[model samples]
Target: MNNAWTDFLARQGTLPARTAEGATVAVPLTQLGLIRSRGEDSAPFLHNLLSNDINKLAADAAELNSFNTPKGRMLASLLIWREADGHLLALSADILPALLKKLSMYVLRSKVKLSDASAELALAGVAGPRTAELLAAAGLPVPAAPRRHAPAGEGRVIRLGDETFIVALPPDALPAAFEALAAAGAQPAGTDAWMLATIRAGLPLVTAATQEAFVAQMLNYELIGGVSFQKGCYPGQEIVARTQYLGKVKKRMFRVHIDAAEAPAPGADLYAPAFEEQSVGQLVNVAAAPQGGFEALAVLRTSSREAGKVHVGAPDGPALRFLDLPYALP
Candidate 1:
């Protein structure tokens, strides 16, 4: 843990608490980790390995991407951005070591070097109607739109969506940044609040348990700008393209609400009456809803989502009610 960042959080008192009306919040994103890919071959090497067209990535933009097995199953989901020297990939910390090793193996003779950047940087999420104002007061340059990024003091601010921005900076610079944000009326929040907002926005995260469980399309990765059908071959390009053109996609991710006491884990099986003993879906990610209960994103068969009654764990488990995603399914 970063002592500076941790101390700043401690000084802020207990978080994940609701703030008064009109107040904003900054949540620490401890679960996320960063991977830096540098050297001359960074762009093309990554372009040939990941699902998105890294060759087209601009220094001021960020994009969602995925790494898949040859069998076309998604192994990891990534948020990629470019910097002056190299590229940065943000993903779940639990899978970072393995992913780094896996990516290194493909380097061969390429001029690419990959390493974990978690220790060098810290990430925090700020949201609420006043986020832009707070960031401006902190001397940070806020991105003008979603997926766009602007330079901050030796770091960057990425606008994830409406009223939501991610602040990435050196660990040593975090305390001052947090202080500035807090002074500007931003409340401190726990990571769960940020995650809850992510689910509501219909973003998908691939956790350890869910690795290789679905293809990019099954998680609606392409629908949300995570895939590029026009890009040249990657590991699973052939299968991904075939699925898209052949119209064989049977499962899709959906946003839903579950009135349960405990939050369901990612990769938990979801059953429907029509599927009998078989699971018709799997939980992708979930978080406690501000309105009570849980809000989650699950990948389920289209048939099950349309007609069958869905349950959390088993056939008789707590029921899941469908919720509209921020974007329409293709």
Candidate 2:
């Protein structure tokens, strides 16, 4: 463990104690342009619009799901947290504006108010086991086991032990929180670390180029508990359910280990030996590997993935080797 944070994480058993400095960053969610949902019909309204069962998400619990167009295209991938009065939708900082505009069109008669709250809150993340202890030591409320999240000091926090929590901190309080956490020994890892951690954790994030490119199944949402086929209709539920029962999922998300120092941009087209002209898949996220090179998550045709020869950054970019994902596909 090179950094104090890494040393603390080693104590908690999160692998690869120290990888890089700037591993974490406190970004403003509202400033990132996230949309908010508040009002009496918020849950039901969202329930009807997204891929997952919004009603099933218990208070303080967080879930990963997507908002898809009627044509089975994922418009935005979100990490949602149910607050006391409404729901907080956390999305990629890059896609916040477009996400807001896309989801806003459906707000018609619904009582929900969709506005960007990213500016009002701070978003922070960590990677490694020591993250839990760091949270506890910082006097922040840590999520009770793995895959749990809670409101800590007016922020929505999720426990991604291999990665840090995606905490929604109050804007004005962010500087103080960052100072405190740094003083307590948390290094500021960049998005690279968090993205790689997410890929390793089997977490998929959606972006512009890949929007509406995949259904929940294609993204392996079922495998990660992001979808409930039994849950009643959400937007495109018919297609989502049919794909599971009647249709075989030809495409799905895959984790790959590549020996490249440069991280590919999200939504970058992925070419495979099987696919000649059309792209076989798209990159969801990438991160620096613990040992060396890089690791990333991508959605691709299962057949192509199984056949191997995955490459990115070129028609003949660096070749990628498949890695076992932390989770199993359905």
Task: Note the Cα lDDT for every prediction shown.
Answer: 0.88, 0.71
Candidate with best lDDT: 1
Candidate 2: stretches off by over 4 Å = 1-33, 160-163, 276-278, 313-315
lDDT of 2 by residue, 1-330 (tens): 023333333343433322654344332222133567998889988888887788878875777778877766777787787878788887766677777787788889988888877656656665565676666666777787555787777776776544457666666565556556666777654455666667778888776656777888888887787777777777777888888889999888888877876767777788887776578888877777767777888888888877888788665888878989887776
Name the 10 consecutive residues with the lowest summed lDDT in model 1: 14-23
TM-score of each: 0.95, 0.85
Write down the RMSD of candidate 2 (Cα, Å).
6.2
Model 1 ranges with Cα > 4 A deviation: 10-14, 17-23
* Local lDDT at 200 for model 2: 74
